[model samples]
Target: MYLTQGLHRMLQMNPAALATVFRGRRRSYGELAARVARLASGLQGLGMQVGDRVGMLGLNSDHFLEYMLGTWWGGGVLNPVNIRWSVPEIVYSLDDCDTRILLVDDNFLHMAEGIASMAKVRPVLIHAGDGPAPAGMLSLEQLIHDSAPIDDMARGGNDLASIMYTGGTTGRPKGVMQSHLNLWSSAVGRMAEHNITPNTSVLHVAPMFHTACMARVVTQVIVGQPHVFVPTFDALDVLRTIESEKVFDILLVPTMLQAMIAHPDFGKYDISSLKRLTYGASPIAAPVLERALELMPGIEFQQGYGMTETSPVISISGSENHSAAGIANGRVRSAGRPALCVTVRVVDEAGIEVPRGTVGELIARGPNVMLGYWNRPEETAEALRDGWMHTGDGAYMDEDGYLFIVDRLKDMIVTGGENVYSAEVESAVAGHPAVAACAVIGVPSEQWGEAVHAVVVLKPGLEVSSEEVIAHCRQRIAGYKCPKSVDFVNALPISGAGKVLKRELREPYWKDRKHGVN
Candidate 1:
C-alpha cells in the first residue's frame, strides 16, 4: 500500500465522488485524476526522472493536491516548501533536497526569483494557477493542458514519497524523508484508531504544508471522504464552515480550539455537525475544554501526540475516553494510548524504560517512522535508534494506558499547533545588544496553549523594554515564534549541569496545578 496507490484506487472505484472543496469550489475525483495525469505527463516531459525531487510552494489549493499526486505519478519525490521561512531558508532547503522542478503560486512567485538568484542550481519553474507564467517559467495549467494523459507511475511501498523539511529550533532545517509505506500506514492506522470512514467529512483548517494537516488528508482520502480545505485557520471562518459545510471532523491544535470556543459569536453557529474532534499540537487548558464541552455536547474529542519523525501519529485518545475516563468516564484531557501497530515506551537517557506513570522521553516504533533526515546521516542515526523513532517529548503512561505530556525533552514551544523552538528564538534574541542573557519558555495562555514567554537579564544601563525585545525577535524569526510576553529578571535560575531550570521559570504560573502546565 503505497501513498500514491490511493489516488489510483479512488479514480477507479469512486470517480464521481467529491475529493476536495477549495475556496467554495469542489473538484471531483475523476476530474482531479485526469488533471493529475496530465500534470504528471508534463513533468515527465520536462526531463523528470524516477526519484528526482519536485518542489511545491503555495497556499492550499486544488492544484497542491494535483501537483502532489502528479509528482508521485511521474515517479518523483515531493518537497513542499515552507511559506513561512525567510528567502535564504527557503533557498537552502530547496538546494539541500536537490530539487530540479518547482511549482509556485501567486503568493510565492517572488520566491522563485530568490531561489534562482541564490541557489547554485535552479529548478525548472511552473507557476500554479490561471495566471500567465513568469519570465522563463511555464504556467502549470498550460503544461497540464498541452500534455497527454499518463498512467500512474506505480511506485510501490517503501519508495520515497516526500522530503518534508522540519525547521529545527536551532541551526538549519532537516529534511525528513517519508516513504510511500510510511504515509499509507500512518493514514490507515489513524483512521482505524479513530474509526473514520467514507462517511467522514474532515475539515482542513490548518495549512497543508504542516505535517498535521497533511497527515489528516491521507486518512480522509483512504476513507474516501471529502475534505473541506480552508487556506488558513480563522476562528469565525472555521465556525462558519463547520455550520455551513457540516464539518464532521476537525484536527486542530489547542490554540485553535480555544479560539473557536472563545469566539464571541461561537454560539451563533450550529456546530452539532462535528462528530469527532482530534487535536494535539500542545496541551489543552482545562477551562477551554470545559467551555468547549458546554458549547457542544455529545462531541467526540480525540488527541494525537507525535512529531514529524513518527509520521506524526504516536498515540491517540478518543471518544472512549473523551467523555469518560477512570470513574470519570469521559475525561477528555488525556492524550490516549499508543496507536494501533505502534510501540510506545517512556525511556530515560540510558534508553532504559521508566516505571509506569514516570515522566521520561517518549519513544515510538512503527512502520510510520520516517526513513531518515536527508543528507544528515549523523543526526538521522541519533534520532532513529533500534528501529524506534525517539520522540523528544516528556510524557508518561498511566495504569489505564493514557499518556500525559508533562513537558518537552527539547524545550519545544508548541503554540497554535505550530512548534516554536526556544533555541531558534534564543538565537534571534541573543543578537540584540540590550540583552546579557535570555531564556525562552512556554507560559500558560488563554488563547494559545503555551505562549512564548521570554525571561531576560538586560545589560546594565540598557534602555531595552519588553516591546523592543519582542520587536527585535519578530524581525529575525517568524511572527508566531516571537515572544507574546516578556519578563525582566535579574537572573535566571540555573541547575548544577549549567542548564536553565525551566521548572523554576514555569512555577509561578503553573504552581497551583497538579502538573507543571494547565
Candidate 2:
C-alpha cells in the first residue's frame, strides 16, 4: 500500500479520533484528511506533475506532516531539506534534483531570498506559516481553501518517494533515493518488532528531516495512531509534554535523552505516561543507559542501528536487551541481530563472510535497501555492489548474531546523531586562506558520540587561531560538521602518493578506547 493509504483508511475507520497535535492546536482525522486532499489538489494546480520533486524546509510541525502526505497524494516526489544546512548546501540540493516547488515555514523564510538567487531556476514558493504570506509565495492555508479535493494517485511499490541528502565521502552531499517500497518495508518491519498498539501515541521530538524519525512517523501513520509534535527537541519541553500530553512512545537520540534526564527540574514532571523510549544514530554510553533505567524503572528502552542507505534500519536492540542483566552481560553494547525483513553479514575485503567476532564491513541485502544514490551511478555501484548495500561501518557479529560496531571504515564522524564526513570538513577547513593542509578526524566525546577534530598546517608565514579556524569553517559548512577542537601543526604526515595518514592522527585519541566511536 502507498503511504497515504493509511490516512484514507483512518478517515473511514475513526474520523473523530485525534490525528495530530502541535503547539496548542489539535486536528481530528476528518479535518486532517480534508485539508490533506485539498492541499494535494492545490499542489497539482500549482504545476506539480507526476514524479516531480517537491521540497519542504521546516521543523517538526503539523504542516510538515501535511506537506509530506499531500505531496505523495498528489503523485509527486519529496525532498526534505536538511534544516542544519547552510544556504549554499540547500540550493545545491534544490538545483541538483531540479526541485521547482518548495514549501517554507516562518523559520526558513529568510533563506528564501538567498535560495532564489543561487538556484538555477527559482522555485515556486508556498509559505506554510501562521503569519501572512510573504511577497511572492502563495499561502498554504489559502491554497487549501481555494482548491477542490482530488483522488489519491495510488503511487506505491518501487515508486520513487524521497530524495534525502546525506553527508558524502566525496566532499559533497549525496542524495539517497528511497522508494515507496523501501520506506514501507522499513516502517512495517520496525512495527512488527515493536508490536505497537493501535492506541499508541508517539511524540515527534527528532527532526522529520532525519530518516530515523521519518521511519517512526511512517509507522505511526500505518498504525493510525495519534502523533504529538514539538517544534524541536528541548529537554524541558520534552519532559513537560510527556506529562501533559500522555505520550506513549517517543524516539530520541541518546544525547537528547541524556539532556532530559540531566535536566535540573526533570523530577518535577509527572511523566508516568511514557511507556517506550527508542534511541538510535549512535551507541549509548553505559552510565547514561543506567541512569535512564534507574529514573524510569517501568519504561522499555530500544535501540536501532543502520544508515540512510538502508532506509535507516537493519537491526534493533530490543527492550529485552536493555534489562539490568542484559546491560551487565554486555548485550547492550551490541547493535542487535537483523530485523525481521533484513539479512545482515559481516564480510572481509575478498567479499567473503568472516568468522563470528571478526571485524569486517557490515553488508546488507533487503527490501528496505535504498534504490541508489541520486545522479551518482559510480558511487552507487561501489556502495551497492553484488546486490548488497556495503555499509562502510566496521562491525563484528557475535556467535549469537549480535553486531558490535567497532569502527567506521569510512572517515565519517557522527556527532549528536548527525553524520559529518571528514572530507567535507577538510574541504571547508582547507578553503581558509591561512591553511596549507588539514585532516579531520573523529574524537571521543561525552556529550556527542564523536566530535569532529581538525589538524591543520598553515601556509608559509601565516597564522590562524583555533577559534578563527572554527569560525572560518562554520561559514562554509554546518556547525556540527565544524571542528570541535583544532590542533596546529608545522606539517602533516603524508604517504608517497600524497595522502594524509589520518590513522596516525587518530591513533592517540582512540588509543585506549574500545570502540572507534564513543
Candidate 3:
C-alpha cells in the first residue's frame, strides 16, 4: 500500500489527535496532514518530478518526518544523506544518485552550500530549520504557507520510495534502492511482532537518516501513533523527555542505552510510561541488558536484526525473547526468528542451506528485500543471488530456527586453519568486570596468517591488563578465538549509529598491507 495512506486515514478519522511533538511544539494530525500536502506541492513547484531523487541532510526532527512523507506524497524518491559523512562523501552520494533537491537543517546548511558548489548540477536547497533561510536556500515554512495543499500521489508497490546510501565496506558508499513494497512490508511486519496500541507514543531518538529508525517511523505512521522527536541523542534529554512526555516506546543502539542507564540522574525521572525499548545495529552485551532490565523492570525489550538492504528489519527478538523464560531457552542470545514477511536461511558459498549449527552467510528472501543498489548492477546481482539477498553476515541457525550472528563474513578472522568470529571474542571480552566496551579485529600475523586482536575500553577508574582480558576470554571461548593480543583504548571508534567501526580499527594496522585481510 501507499505510505501516505496512513496519513490520509488519520486526517479523516482523528484529525484533532496529536500527530507529533518536537521540543515543546505539538502539531495535530490535521495540521501535519495539511503541512505535508502543502510541502509536497512546494517541492513539486520546485521541479521535483515523479520518481525524482530528493535528499535530506539533517538531524532527527518533526521537519525530517515531514520531508520523508512529503517526498513520497509528491511521488518522489528519497536520498537521505548520512549526517556523519564528509563533504566529499556526501557529494559522492548526491552525484551518484543525481539528487537535485536537498533539504538541510541548521547543522548542515553550510555544508549544503559546499555540496552545491562541488556538484555537477547544483541542487535546490530547502532550509528545514528554525531560523530563516539563507540567501540562496528556500525556506521550508514559506513553502508550506505559500503553496496550496495537493492530494497524495498514491505511489505504491514497486514504485521506488528511497535510495538509502550505506557506507561501503570497500570505502565508497552505495545507494540501496528501497521500493514502496520494501518499506511497507518492513513496517507492517514489525508492527505484527510488537504490541502497538492506539495510545502508543514512540520516541524517535536515532537519526531519521538511518533505515532502522525510519522503518520505525513508518510503523508509527501506519498505527497513527503520536511521535516525539529529539534532534539528537543525549542521555539527560532522553530521560527528561520520557518523564515529561510520558513516552511509551523508544528505539536506541546498545551504546546509547548504556549511557542512559548509567546516567547519574536516571533514577530522578518517573519513567513508568515507557513500555517498549527496541534496539539494533549491534548486539547488546549481557551486562548492559541485565542493567537495563533491572532498571526498567516492566519494559519489554526487542532486538531487531537487519541492514539497509532489507528495508532494515529481517528478524526480531520479541519481548518474551528478552525475558527470563526465553533467556533460559537460549533465545535471548539469538537474533530471533524471521519477521512476518521474511524467510531466513544460513547458506554456504554454493548457496546451499547448511545444516543447523553450521556457520554460513545469513541470506534472506522477502518483499522487504531492497529492489537493488542504485547504478551498481554487478554488485546488485552479486548481493541478490537467486531470489535471496545475501546479507554477508556470518550466522548459524539452531534447531529452533533462532539465528545467531557471529560476525561480518569480511570481519571473520582466519587464524591458522580456524575461523574466529569477532563477535564471539567481543562478547567474552565484554563480560570482564572492568571492561566498558570492546571490539575485536584481525591483525597481520606471520605465524597464524591473521591474529585475533582485541581493542578495549575499561570503565573509569577500573583497569584490566591484556593478559587478564585474554585469560577471561579463554574461559568462555576457544584459545584460537581469544585475542592473541589486546590494546587498551579510551574508547572505540563508533559510527553515528553507535556500532563500533571495525574497518576504522583495522585501517591503521592494514594500511601497509596490500589486502584488507591478512
Where does candidate 1 stray beyond 4 Å? Answer: 324-331, 412-518
Best by TM-score: 3
lDDT of 1 at 96: 93
Summing lDDT over every window of 10 consecutive residues in candidate 3, give the lowest-scoring window.
191-200
**lDDT scores for all predictions?**
0.79, 0.86, 0.91
What lDDT does model 1 reach? 0.79
Higher-lDDT candidate of 1 and 2? 2
State the lDDT of candidate 3 residue by residue for 147-235, as single tens digits: 99898999999999999998776858889999999999999987776768886688999889999899989988888999999989999
Compared with the true structure, what per-residue lDDT tens digits does model 2 show for residues 1-518?
68898898898899999999999899988898899999999999989999999999998999999999999999999999988778999999999999999999999999988898899999999999998999999999999999999999989999999998985334688999999999999999888877987876799988898888888888888888999999888899999889889999998876578668878899999999999998887545455667788998899898889888898899999988889778878887788889989998999998899999887899999999999988999989999988899988888899899998765666767899986767557767877778766778999999998999999987778898999999998998888889999999987764221235676788899889998743
Q: Could you give candidate 1's per-residue lDDT for residues 164-266 as a string of tens digits?
A: 8875544788999988888888878877766765755778876677777778877766667787877667899899988888899998876578668767898
The residue-level lDDT of candidate 2 at 79 comes to 97
